[model samples]
Target: MRPLTAQDPDQLGRYRLLAQIGRGGMGQVLLGQGPDGRLVAVKQIHRQFTGNPEFQARFRREVLASQQVTGAYTAGVVDHDAESATPWLASEYIAGPALQDMIAEYGKLTVSGLKLLATGLAMALLEIHRTGLVHRDLKPSNVLLTNDGPRVIDFGIARALEDDLALTQTGTVLGSPAYMSPEQAECRPLTAASDVFAVGAILAMAATGASPFEAASTPQVLYNVLYTAADTSAVPPPLRPIVEACLAKDPAARPTPEQLLDLAGRIEAEPVWPVRIRRHIADCHAEAMAWADGTARSATPQAPAPPKKRWQRLVPIAAGVSVLTLVAIAITGIGQEGTAVAMDDPPLALTDDETRGLDVCALMKPDVLGELGTAVGELVPGGVTGCRVYYLDQSGQKIYFGLETSIPVGETRSGNQPMGTTINWMPVLGRYREALSCDRSVVTQSGLPLALTMTATPNAGNGCPAAERALAAVVRRLAVNPPLRADAPDSVLRMDACTLIDIAATSAVVGDPVRERTPHGCAATGRDGYFAVDIDDRVRPDNVVGGKVRPTTTIAGREVYVHHEAETYCEFIVMIRPTRDDRAEQVHTTYYSTLPDPPDTCDTAAGLLAPALAKLPTS
Candidate 1:
C-alpha cells in the first residue's frame, strides 16, 4: 500500500482512509477505517466519469444490486452514496492474494484446494443469480481468495436482472476475453450459464497454468473459443467433468451453481489451504490489525478486512454452516496486451547466453545440494555451448550434472529415458543406474532450450526424488530468465563468464590455447611457457594487477591498468562496464604470464577484448 499522497483525502464520508488498496479502470480502492472500529475497502469513482449521468446511474445500480447480494463467498456491501459529487462504495474488506499471483508463485493448488475454489465460486454465482444480477466482469481479478474461502468481489460492472438499462455501448464487448464463454464472446445475451462456463475456465486455469482459450492475442483467443474445443489435457482427471460441463458451448447443457454445490459435497473450511497460503491468510489478518493500529501509516503493505455492526461482532469469525474456502484471487484483465511476433517478421536478435542457454552450474546451489549430503564442486563453463556442475558427496563420491542448451525437437535426445511426467509443460527425462546414480534431463522453454542430465555416484533412493524436485524447481526459476553468471546482464542477472572471455586472444599469447574451462574464466596453456587470459575480471589490486600496478594506455587507445611492462610477470586489464557492486563495476579482460621473457601479457588480453568491444554500436 502506498502512502496517501497530497491529492488524497484523509476522510471519505465517515470512513477514514488508511492506505491505497488498489486502483482499477473504474476507480480507486482505499483501505479505510469505519466509525465503529471496522476496516473497510472504499472504492471511489474516477474523476472523468464523475459528472456523467450514465456513470452515476451505473454506480447507483451497482449500489442497489450489491446491497441485495448476501452470500458467504462475497464482499457484502457496507455503505454507498451514488448521488455524491465523487461516487463511492464501501464493502467489508476482503484481503487476500490475487489468485493469479498465488498460482504463479506456488504451483497449481492441490485437488482439495481446487475443489474448494470451484465450490465456493459456484455458491457465490448462485447468490448473484438468485439476486437477479449477472456478473459480466467475472475474471480471476474479481475473485478474492480469502481465508474464509473465495469471496467474489467487484460488482462495478454487474448488470441488474430486473432492469433493461443498458450501460454498455453496442458492439463494445465486455468481460475478460480469455475467460469469456462462447455466448459472451459473440456478444449474445448472457445468463447464469455463461458464468458457469467462466467457473469452468477458472478451474481449468487453476489446474493448469494455461487457460482453455489461451493465445497470443484477444482476437485469436476469441476465435479459438468460437471454433476450437478447449485443450483440457492439462487439467487433472477428477476435475475434468466440471471443466467440460462448464466449458460446454451450449449454456443450457451447463450445471447450475446448486448442482456444483452438490458435487462439492459437504466440505468444511478448517485451514485446508497449503502452508504458504495459510501463512498468507495469517499475514492478511496481521496487515488488517496493523492498519487498525496505524502501522500502515508508513509505506508498508496492508490487507483487506470487514467490519459489521457491534451486534455482528458477537458471532465467530468463521462459524456456523460450512465455511467453504477455495478459489484463488487473480488480478488481471480480459487478455494480456502484447504484440505477437508474425511468422514473416525478421528473426528477433538473441543474447549470446540465450543462443546457448544451458548453464548447469547456474542451477547448482551448494546449500540445496547439502540437503542430499552433497556439496557443489567444480564448474565446467561451456559458454553458450552448454556446461556441467560437479558435486561431491559426504563420502567423496563424484556426481555430475551435465546441462546442454539446444533447439526444440520433436523428441528427447537419444539415450535419455523420459521420466514419464512433465512439470510446467516441460518433459523431464530420467535415467537411473540401479542404486548408483540417477541421470535426468529437462526440456525447458523454446528460446531457452535445455537438457539437464544429473547423475550421482553410489546414489540412494533419495537421489531420484531430490534430483526430480530440484530439477523442477530449477526449471521453474530458470524457465523465463536464469542467471548464468555472477555479473549483471542484459536480461538475467548473470551471464556465462566463458561467453564474456576472449579465447582467441589468450591462444595468440601461448601459441594455441588448450581451452580448459573454469567457473568465471578458463585455464589455458601457452607455447613458450604458461600464459593465462582470464576474461572474468574481478577488479582487485592483487587479482588484476601482476608485478607492479600502474595506470597505462592500451594499443587501441583504451584506458587500462598495467602491471610489469618489461618482463617476468605482466598483467593488463581493459575496462568494460561500471557497476555499483564492484564485482562487475569494471568490466575488464586481464592477461597474466610467468614467461620470464618478452611479449607483454597485458597487450595480449587487450587485443582480444578490443575486437568484441569495437563491434558493439553502444559500446
Candidate 2:
C-alpha cells in the first residue's frame, strides 16, 4: 500500500478528514468530521504495527478500554476498526494546544494554573480507573488544556485490568521512562496506582519545569525512577507533599486517583487561588489579543473614527465626509486648506524631574536576575550582545538591571586588532526607564561603543523603587566577574562594567518594536538574486560502498517578497511571481525534502531541512 500523504484519500469509512492534527510513535491523528458533522480525532496506525497480530490485539483492548471510560475529563473513544488494513480509532476532538507546547511557549504554569491542571487530570484518571484501564502514558504531551478544562488523550498504550498480555515481554518496559512508576519500570504487574503516580509527575512538571527523575539518558532515568527518591526542592510547598508521595518508590505510598481529585478540589476552593489563576489566564488572553490587534491594524491602512451616538449618526457621517475631504486636501500637499482639529486635553509631557525620580530597576529580585542572565548567556554564548534581568512584584511594577557586552564580529586572526566591538547596558533597566518616560544613555568602554534611550508611562498604581534598586544591584554584580577569574574561561568572564545616569526629559512616544524572522536572502531589481536547493538521500553504513542512492531532488525559486508557507509531514506551497528585471537574475532559491509517508499533519520545517540548502549573492 502507498504511504499516506496530505493529498491522499480523506474519507475513511464514515469519517471525513478535516485536517491532520498530530502524529506519534504509533500512529497519526487526524481532525475529522464524523456523523452529524461532529468533530472527532481519528488515529491511523502505521502498516508495520498492523502486521503484528499481538499489536492488533493490544489496540483492540485499548479501544475496548476507551469505550468503557466515560467522563468530561477524558477523551472517550467513539469508534475504532482494528481489523482494517491500517487500523484507525476515533475520539472526541478537544480544541487546545498540548500542555507541552503551551508550557514551552509560555514558561511553567503558575501555582493556580498548576492546581487547575492537577484537578482536571486527577478527575480524568478517576474516570479511566473506574473503567479498569490504566493509562500507561500520562506525560505532558497527552494532556490538552481547553478553555473548559483539561482532557486526557492517547490511549494507544492503555492496559485493561483483565488483560493478561498487558505486561511487556521478557525484560522490556512500556510507557515514557520520565513519568513511569517504580512498579511499571521494574516490570511488576500494573495497577490503577500507576496512573496516579503518572498524574503526580505531570502536575510536578507543570508546577516546576523539571521532572522528579530527570536524567540525561532513558536507562538512567528509569534507574532513578525505580531506585532513588525524586528531588522536590524546586516544587512549591503547597504541591510538594502531594507530588512527592505520588512519586514514592513504593506503589502503596501513592494516593488513589480519587484522593488526588479531592486534594485538587480543595486547592481549587481556596479564596486566592481562583483570582490568581484568572489573572494568569487573563494575561495569556491579553497577549494573544494584543498580537491579533497588531496584525489587524497593520493589515488594514484605515484609521479608526471617533465614536458618536446613534441619534447623532447623520451628523457624525457628515463630519466623517468633511474629515476625508480634509485628508484629501492634506494629501495634495496644500496643508493650509485643511481644517485644524481641536485637541482633547493637550498631552502633558514628562518633565526632567519626574524622569530622574522614575527608578525602574528595583522591581526584580537577585535570583530572577541571575536566572535571566544565565538563560540568555546559554542561548547565544559567543553571539550574545548583552543581557538584562528584571521582575515585577505582586503589584505590577518594573525593577531591573542589565549588563552589556560586545560579541566578536567575525572570525579572529593572529595579531589582528580584534574586530570592532559594540556595547550597551542591559535593556531591561532601559525598558523600565522608557516605561516611565525617562531618557537614558550608556558610555563606551574597552573599544566597545554603546547607545540607548528609554521612556515609561506609569500604570494606575504607584511603582516600587526598592525592587528596582535591588534589581539594579544584581545586574551590576552580574556585570562584574567573580573573584579569582583571571584565568577563567572566556565563557566565565564578564565583558564589561560601568555606571550610567538617567537624565530627565520630556515624555516621548515609545512604540512596540518590530520582530522579523531570519531572512533567507536579499532581493534586488525585483528579480531572484539567489535560490535554494534541497537534496534527499538515504544514509548508509560506513562499510557499505555507494550503498544508498539519492531518493529525490526538489529545486524551487521564488520572487522576492513572496510569502513562504509550509505544513509538516504533508505538503508545502511556495508562492511564485513573474521576474520583472530584464536580466532574469535568480535572486533566491529554496529546497525541501519530503517525508515518504507524511502523516495527515506534521511539522513542515523538520520535513524540509534535511534535504535543503540555499544560495545567496556574495554582495
Candidate 3:
C-alpha cells in the first residue's frame, strides 16, 4: 500500500539490503546479501503490524512453515528474527524475476514453459504438503523463473494444518481471492489439495494471460472461483484437460501434486512443447533485457521472433566465456578491497575474433548477465544490443577487458548505463590502467562495494554533488579507526569500536573536518560502539518527517537520534558505548549507501552496512 523508504542499517537484523525488489499487501520485499555474500530476499512486515501479537504469531508460523519446506523448487527460509520489535524474514534470493512479471511483459509461456512451470509448482506443492503446511497464496507473482528452474516463494500467509489460528481472527479472509480454493474461501478445513487447486489456477494463468475466474470485484471473483467453472477454451488444447481437472471445485476431484507432475510430463512429451518453451523463455529474457536497457516502457509481451541460424561453433564459446567472465568479475570485484589487484594467475585470453569484436561495446555488459540478450531478442519485437560488464580494479592492479559494444555518449537511455565510474579501472585491454579504478578501501559494513557515483541520470534528475557527497560519506565512515589500546589517547580509537558519540566527541574536541552535504548516509562501528548517520536530508516518502518526528533516545545509556534536519543533510546518529570498559581499545568504521526513510525499504543500504557493523567490536 505504501512505498518502502530507507531506514538505519542497524535497525534491521542480520540480512543486508540490496534493492527494493517488490511490494505487496503484506509488506515490502527487499533483495539482500547475506553473510556468505549470497543473495537473499527479506520481507519486512508493515509497521502497522509491529504491535500486533497475532500478526507476530502468524509471522512465526510462516517462518516455521517455510523452513519446513526448504527444497529444490522452494525458496528456502535462511534466517529470521520473528521476535524482533519489527519482524523480518529472509529467504534465498532466486535470480530471475517473477512469473507474473514475465508473462505480463512477454506474454504467457509457450507449451513447454507451461509444463516446466507446472512441474515446478507441483513439486513445490508436494514439498509444502509434506511439511503439513498449505501455501494459501500460490499466485504467479510468488513463482520465480530462475536459470536453474522455477522457485516458489512468499509463504507469509502459509498455514500449518495442526497449528492454531494465531494471526487471523475467525471471520477474516486470508488468501488471494482469485487463487483461493473453495475450502479456503469458505474457511473450511484445508488439505494439500487446496494448494493443488491454487497451483491449477496458477498454471491456468501461466498458460493463458488471464485467471480461470475473472471478475471486477472480490465478491464476484470469489463467486466465480467457488461456484463457476473455469473457461478452459483459452488454455492450449494440449494443456486444457490438466488445468480443468486441477480447477475442479471439489478438492477430492483435484489432481495430486504427483499426478500434476505426470500431467506435465505428458504435456512435455507433446512435439510442440519444447519449441514453445524455448521461445517463451527467450522472449521473457528479451523483455526483461529491454526493461533493463531502458528501451521498452511497457511490459506488454510481443510476438516471438523467428528462429535464427544455429552457429554450432559459437555456442560453446559463448557459454564458456560468458560464465567464466561473469564468475570472475563477480567473485573478484564484488567485495574486494584496495585497487584492481591482479590475481595470482594470468587473465584468460580472448581468442575468438567475435570475442575481440565485443570490445566495441565496452560499458553495456553487467557482471552477471545470463542469457539476457538472446532471451530479449526472441521475446520482444526489436532486438537488444549486447549486455556490458563493468568493474573497479580495487586490487591496485591493472587488467584489460573488452566490452561487447562501445559506450553510448551523452544522456540517451538507449543502453543500460554502467553505474559508478566509466573509466574502466579494469580495462578490457591495453596497458596497466589506474585512471578508472575506484579507491578499493571503500566498502559497506557487509563488505560489498558501494556505488560511488551514479551510472545514469534518473528521472528525478542528476544530483552530482549529492552523489559525490554520498560517496565521501561512505569513505569518511569507513576510514575512521579506533585506538589500539585503552591507555592510548582517545584520538587513536579503533575504527571498529568507534561510535557516533566517539565521532561527535572527537569532532567537538578535534574539529570535524569533513562537512559535505552527502546524498548518502554514513555508518561506523568499533569494538566499544556502533553508529549510523545519514549525511543528506533526503527523507523518503514512508519516513516520519516534519512534525511527527521523535527525539533521540539512549540505548545502553548512549544517546541516539534520528535527526530529520541538519545543515548538511537529514541524518540519524546512533551511538553505543563499550561494555568491557577495561581492554586494549580499538575502533572500526564501515560506511555504506545513504539510508532511505522507513517503508521505502533500505535493504541494499542495510546489506552494505551490516557486515561493517558486525565487524565493530562488541564488548
TM-scores of the candidates are: 0.48, 0.44, 0.45
Worst 10 residues of 2 by lDDT: 321-330
Native-referenced Cα lDDT, model 1: 0.57
Error of 3 at 581 (Å): 52
Residue-by-residue lDDT tens digits, candidate 1, 5-110: 5556799889998877654333567778898988888777656457767557657767787788879988788887777777788888765766655665576777
- What digit string (tens of lDDT, one per residue) describes model 2 on residues 1-619? 0123443347776887654454323445665666686666677775645776666776776677678777887777777787999888877765555665455545577767777788888888888888777877677767766656677876656767666233443333346556767766666667888888888887777776666776533345567777787787888877777888788777888888788877776663332223433444455444333332344223344465343322111111110000000000000001112111101110011222221122222212233243222221221111122334444434444434343222121211111231111111122222232233332322221112222221212333323233233333332322221111121132111211111000010001011211111111111111111112211111211112356422322333421221233332222222121222221112222322233443323133223322222322211
Q: Which candidate tops lDDT? A: 1
Kindly report which residue stretches of model 1 are placed more than 4 angstroms away from their true locations once superposed: 162-173, 266-271, 298-619
Q: How high is the CA lDDT of each candidate model?
A: 0.57, 0.44, 0.46
Instruction: Please list the residue runs of candidate 2 whose C-alpha ends up more than 4 Å from where it truly belongs after superposition.
Output: 1-7, 164-172, 268-619
TM-score comparison, 1 vs 2, better candidate: 1
- Compared with the true structure, model 3 gives a TM-score of 0.45
